[model samples]
Structure formats: C-alpha cells, structure tokens
Target: MPLVNRDQKHYPGLAQTTNYNLSSFKAAEIITRDVVVIGGGSAGTYSAIAIKDKGKSVVFVEIKNRLRSRTETYKDPKSGRGIDIGVIVWYVTPRVGSEPNTTGAVFDLKTGRGLNAPPPNQTAIGIAFQIYTQQLLKYPELDAGMFLPDPAPDDLVMPFGQFASKYGIEAALPTMYSFGAGVGDILATPTVEVMRAWGLSLISSLQGGFLTTARHNNSELYGKAQTELLAAKSLLLRSRVVYTERSTSGVRLVVKTPTGNKLIKAKRLLITIPPKVEILKRFNLTTQETSVFKKFLNTGYYTSVVKNTGLPDTLSVTNFSPDSPYGIPKMPAVYTIGSSVYTPGLKLAFYGAPLTNVTSSLPAKTVKDAIIASIKRQQTANPANPTSFNQTTPTFAEYHSHAPFWLQAKAVDIKAGFYKKLYALQGIRSTFWTGGAWRAQDSSDIWRFTAEQVLPKVLKGL
Candidate 1:
C-alpha cells in the first residue's frame, strides 16, 4: 500500500475522471498497485524497476510488445546475427583510457572513390570542442534535466549557429551537426537544446570511449529488464492506456491489454511517454498541463536496415550540402547511408526531418523512396562503378520510427519559464513525469535523472 497525497487545494478538479465512458468497462478486472508507469521505454522501465526495488508495487504498461524503444535489433536471416540499427553506442563516465584512432574519408559520388583531400583542421576542431564543452559545463544541470536558472543566460537561448560564431567554434559545427543527428537543423536550434542533445556525458565519451554490447545487440539490456519485470509480474506488454483518471489522492487507468481490458488503480502515475497534447489528452490533463504540453515541438527521426543498396560495404556515405553552413544537409533528408559494422552487404540509413506541425509524420515509403533515389543518383553520377541499381531494387529489411523525438519548445516559451512550469507539474494530481522530453535525450542521462531525482521524489510520496 502507498500513502495518497490529500493536498488538492492548489489543483481543483483533482478528483476521479476518465477519458472513456465508465459503462463500457464495467466488466474489466480491477488491479491495484503502488505506482503505474506508462510507456515502458528507457525512463519508464528503469523507474519501474527502481520503484519495485524500493519495496513498492508497480505496474508497467507499454504499447509495444518490447520494452526498449530506440534500441531495435534486426536479426540477419543469413548469418542469424543481430544487427543493431538503433542506439548503437553508450557513454560511460571516468575516462576509459585511450581509444582507437578511427579515420573517416568523404566518398565522392561523382568519382565513385574516396576524396583525396586533407582532413578537417584537428587543432581548430580541438580548440572549438574545448570551448564548446567549457560552455556546456557552465550549466551542469543540463546533463540530467532542463533545470536552468530562472533567467537563462543570453548565450543559452541564442541560436546555436550564432553561439558557434560568437565563440569562434565554427570548426566544431560539423562535429556537432554529426552528433546532433535526429535533431533537425542543429545550427538553428536553441543553444540549450543543442546542449541537451550533445551534453556532458557525450563529451566525456569523446574524451574517454564509447561502449557497445559484447554481442553487438543493444536490445539485450532491455531484454534483461523485461525478464526482471516479468518475474515480478509488474509488466504488461502490448498494452495501451485507453482511459485514465488522476486525482490529488491517487490515479486510476483502464488499459487495453492483449488479453483484455484491465482497470489499474495506483497511488502515483508516472508517465514516461512523450507528453504531446494528442497523446496526453486521454490522461485527463488539467488546463495548465494541457497548455504546457501543447507548446512542445518535436523532430522526426527514423532508422532502417536495407540490402542491395548499390553501395560498397567499404564505402560510407554522409549527406553534405556545400551551400549550407558547415555543409550540414537540409532536413527531411537522409542523414547517412553506411555499411553495417557486423553485417556486410547490408547498409543502415538514418533519416531526420524537422517538425512541420504537431502531427507531422514521415512515412516509411517516403524514406525508402528517398534512399533509393539517393543511391541511384550516386551510381549514375559515376557510370564506371561496377554495382548498379538498374536491375536490383533495395529491400528494406527493417524500419523503425523514433519520431516525436527531441521534444522542445520555442525560444520565447523556454525563456518565458516553460521548463519551470513543466517541472512544476510533477506530483500534481498524484501524477509524475520523466523521459527524454523531461531530460536529456540519452538513455544513461535519463536513467540517472529518474533514479537519482525522480524516483526519490516518487518514493517519498509513496
């Protein structure tokens, strides 16, 4: 059992409510738990496990059958080996000695060969990196969450490109652009938003080294978590919240599971899902919460694994635009097409698009068409290339959407205390929040924030 917070004076309408009609779920089985965690992604999964470890009962709900969202593994039918297409690397603290020197070469589509040019100015890049990192260090809270000073510094709110020029870190723009992939138009993004994408942990990883799973399958981590949650009978896969009611005292939800609908009653509601108004409308959001969430904007990101790409396994193609600043390619475009490290003859393509509207979507066919066109353009640019897409069409083995990602607000809203109001929603109506949207968009960083900051507060309430 958990203690219910009875303080509802500050928030009116903090009483029983539901998005759907009560008569519809009269036969649903009622379930009770101390906490109900929605969206079994990185933050949700971690928080549920931590809550259970703290001697509290928790029920984890996920729309998908799997736990991890970004980490997707495509098993190659030929080799029977898992090829990690999403979230391939993670950062570890406390510098991990020296890393191997890796070389990158720009392949010329017109020439069908690697460009014979000098590498980027290492000295300039190093200096720019140092200055950029020092600037990020000034706001240490960004590593975990957006707990900025009341009056955020001008530098933090300014456009990242302006910040780069102001600090003479133009040499670092390309690097940042690469690191900030999936975040459309990094240079135009607010400085703080860019920092959230490429924050302190990533900087440390650059200085130290990145770690990947031994089996090259990042999903293994979540698989283990799923096993633990299943053993505790705290997980509900292939389930979605069809209706929810949150009051100051506690919360109740009607979840549509694969087996049947189940009514969940809990003292606290932890929503780790992306809090878009369209998604949260069913949660019976307060006027203030609705107003805050409606302002959030997010980018569209997708990943795919394909074969017969007409690209050599040795060649790595990076989208570039000489016209754009730092040669960053335009949005709604293919970011990269590279050979899979473990699976030869297979290529992975990453695509990113800017948010046009709240409901903007990028179709898989649209992405696949773009990739094919790009590959054909490359092969046609150089007729001498032996491989050609004239006969064979690239087969898309796997495609995953990571959209509604990199959630952020306009500069005006951020400066007008958007985060302050957003964070204030915690513990209100007996509901809490944590996820990439609430914190930095990194698994490790989100876990730290959930465990160290959010879970403590949640435990105290319980």
Candidate 2:
C-alpha cells in the first residue's frame, strides 16, 4: 500500500540487484531505456511502439528470435500458393456491406462477403448466451468492455459442462468450443472464465465473421510492428530476461541476447507474456508477489503447418469421437481441434490444452504423429468417405509452441479483485503487466487496452 516513491531500493549505492548476483555480471554491458517491454507479441510490440510514439525511450525484448509469434508459409508444390501454418487472421470492425446472418455466419470486413458456408445450427446456443446477458448488471465492469469479466464465484469454479447442464444449455457447448481452441476442452474450463477470456468482441467476430487476416499471414501484423519498432531502434529480438532489479526509481533487467548479455534499465517494465510462477520467480519477487502469481493457472498451445498429410486436400478435419455428435466431448484437450488446407497438400494443425501437459510439451514429431493418427481415424470413421491415409505420416513444415499460455486465476481470487492487485504491482518496484492475462487475448483489444489503460499509468509514474 506504500507509494514506491518512499522506497530507496533505487537510491545511489543501495544494495546490488538482489535477485541475481551482479558480481559475476558485466556492468559495462548495461543499457538504459525509459521503458523495457518484454514478450514481443501483440501487447508487448504495441506497448513498445506506443511508448516510443510518446517521445519516450523504450526497448522491446522477446524470447523468440523473431518479433512475433512464429509464422511460416509453405509453398504448395503443385499450385505454388502459400499455405500459412501459423497465425491466420485479424479481427476488424465489420465493413458497411457486411452483416450478420440468421445463422451467425461471419463476413469479411474488407470484402464484406460472408463465408460460403452458413454457420452451424446455433438457435439453442443463443438461448444459452442469455444467461450471460441476464447477469451483466451484476458485473458492470465487464458489461461495456471488450475484456472478459471476472466471474461470479460459482460460475468461476464450475466447469463448462456442469455450467451448461445446470442451465439446460448443453446445445451451446459445441458452438462455444471453438472459442476454447488451443486452450483445451471447454467442458473443463470455468464457464464464465472462458467467456471472459474470449470476451464479446471475439464472440461477435465469430457470429458475424468479421475477422480479417493479413494479406501475407498473421505474422504480417507483427512484421509491421517490428519494422516500425526497428525504425525507432527499440526492438531486441531473441532476448531473455535473466535477472531484474526493481526499486522505487526504476527497473533494471539483465537480458541475454544472441550476442551477449545486456543490462536494460528502465523507468517502467511492461511484461506481456503469460506470467508463469516459475518464470516470475526469476525476478526478485517478494513472497506476496510470488504467491499471487502462483495462484494463476497456465495453458499450453502448439500450432504447426504440415505437408505430405496424404489426406485429400479438399477434406476438412474436425476431431471428435464417433459418439459425440452435438457437443465437445470431454477429453484431455481438443487434440488437433481442426485442420484445413492452405494450399493443395499443405495444411495447418492447432493443438493445445487449458493446463500445462504433454500435449503441448511433447516433441513436434510426436504431436504430428498424433495428428496423423487422428486424421486417419476420422477418415476411417466417416461412412461417406471411407478413405485411407495410405499409412503415410504427415511431415512437419513449421512448429511453434505457445506453451503455458492463457494464465487465469481462481474465481475466488478474481472476485477479490486480483486485477486490482495486479495493477497495484505496476508501479511497485517500477514493474508493470499487460497482455491476455491482464486484458483481452485479441491483438486489437490488447493494443487498445495497452494504449488506453497501461501506458497512462506508466507515463504518470515516469
């Protein structure tokens, strides 16, 4: 509760960086910036750019060698067209000609064209969503925002399957399951937390099909940010925050780069990555800070592009057992939730779980094998197609693991205003937080929240 201005950890000749031994560190490599934004994803990149635009100095740091999430495009041998294996689209406001259909089909923002296929049957889904609307007044903070709302304790702790059955809304499960893609089986997630994580914007996008993708790929957006940040001399790709020194005056981070270790001293620290307790423990966390971070649950997601799948290019695959026809059946996770061809014979696969598990931690070959097995199973199970995979395994073209993501706190912690405490830690030790954990998962929303909410506090302190 004390203002950081009273703390003297930053005072001249005070204790050296307490988390890691500075005696063995090279002080000569120290670099200073007004802000050090970690995790060069949507929020981190946006924050770095925004800070620089404000006429302040900043350095962007990311563990990946590239500025954005790993995106690769494979060229189809026969068609010579690119197949994006990573990020695919952007969620933009619906254009004038675009309109939602009776079936909740999506329309492209630029072209204003609805998808060729109509939306799945969702009449029952609409009835289920009424529960959220009915409870809106109880949580006003979530009503007018793009971010997810803190759930009522009961909804927060209750799993999705139970929540759906309790309200006689089991029909909505499959419709909402895709929203839980890469997170895990929605049936296991806290019902409201899933709603909060995706927020209304994404739901609207799905229902109306207003989501837009970059011309090149999802990486294009990040590429744009990277170019801009590079022009500003604020990007540090392939950087790891090895140690941190926090005090009343500023935050100093020891970042390991491809070249060597460099010290980054900044007035504010904006961390956009999923704050895993193990990762956070690296910083000089007080017991209270550690405890709060430890309360969060982390998810694992792995996405990839593949070739030689040996399946017909025209066939679209969705993973489900033979028994479940209308709902997302309970499983460890949505193993290869869906697969679509980007070009002839080249495809993309997305796999993950709400909890940190081997599905995400396993080697790329193992995951690829599983996807092939699932595809073979689906093909064999289909009475209409009855096609065989020829016992051929798919070859991986690109692999990117966004493991230990979607950090969430317990319902009790959320109701206790965990975010307020999260924000309170902002200026404490001159560190701040952002990204999906603090805001919405979508890039558009994360950028908006960083610009509107996070940067102001950072600037005020600066």
* Local distance difference test, each candidate: 0.79, 0.61
TM value for model 1: 0.90
Weakest ten-residue segment in model 2 by summed lDDT: 105-114
Model 2, which residues run further than 4 Å from truth?
1-28, 70-82, 95-120, 136-138, 143-153, 214-216, 322-326, 333-342, 354-360, 379-391, 412-420
- The superposed Cα distance between candidate 1 and the true structure at residue 190, in angstroms, equals 0.4
Give the clashing residue pairs of candidate 1, or none: none
> In candidate 1, which residue ranges exceed 4 Å CA deviation?
1-28, 93-104, 107-117, 386-391
In model 1, state the lDDT of residue 436: 89
What RMSD does model 2 have?
A: 8.2
lDDT of 2 by residue, 213-322 (tens): 43345566677888888787688887777667788788877666777767787888878877656566446776667667767776666777667765556545444443
Pairs in clash, predicted candidate 2: 90-212, 106-208, 106-209, 107-209, 148-196, 183-353, 183-354
